[model samples]
Target: MPQLEPFYFVHLLVWGFINLLIIIYLNTKYILPRILYIYLSRILISKL
Candidate 1:
């Protein structure tokens, strides 16, 4: 098999890191709050 280029590995690593950061940011910013709201609402409804 042929060897891969060094730049390809670097590019892939950079993109992977960027994608991971975006996912974490989105989860905390949007998904987490939505989930928390749903959970809190359920609790509130149960108490009523």
Candidate 2:
């Protein structure tokens, strides 16, 4: 079998951390509020 390279693992770790940070930032900045608004609006409309 051919020997696999090692640096690929380091690159994957760095990108994974960066992607996780972006997901957390997006959830805090945008997705949470948008989801809340949609949920609240549906409940409000149903109550009428």
User: Which residue pairs of candidate 2 clash?
Assistant: none
- List ranges where model 2 is wrong by over 4 Å: 1-7
Per-residue accuracy of model 2 over 1-48 as CA lDDT, tens digit each? 234556777789999999999999999899999999999999999999
Q: Which RMSD values do the candidates have, in order? A: 2.5, 3.2
Q: Put down candidate 1 lDDT per residue, 1-48, tens digits, no spaces.
A: 236687788999999999999999999999999999999999999999
Candidate with maximal lDDT = 1
Return the top candidate by TM-score: 1
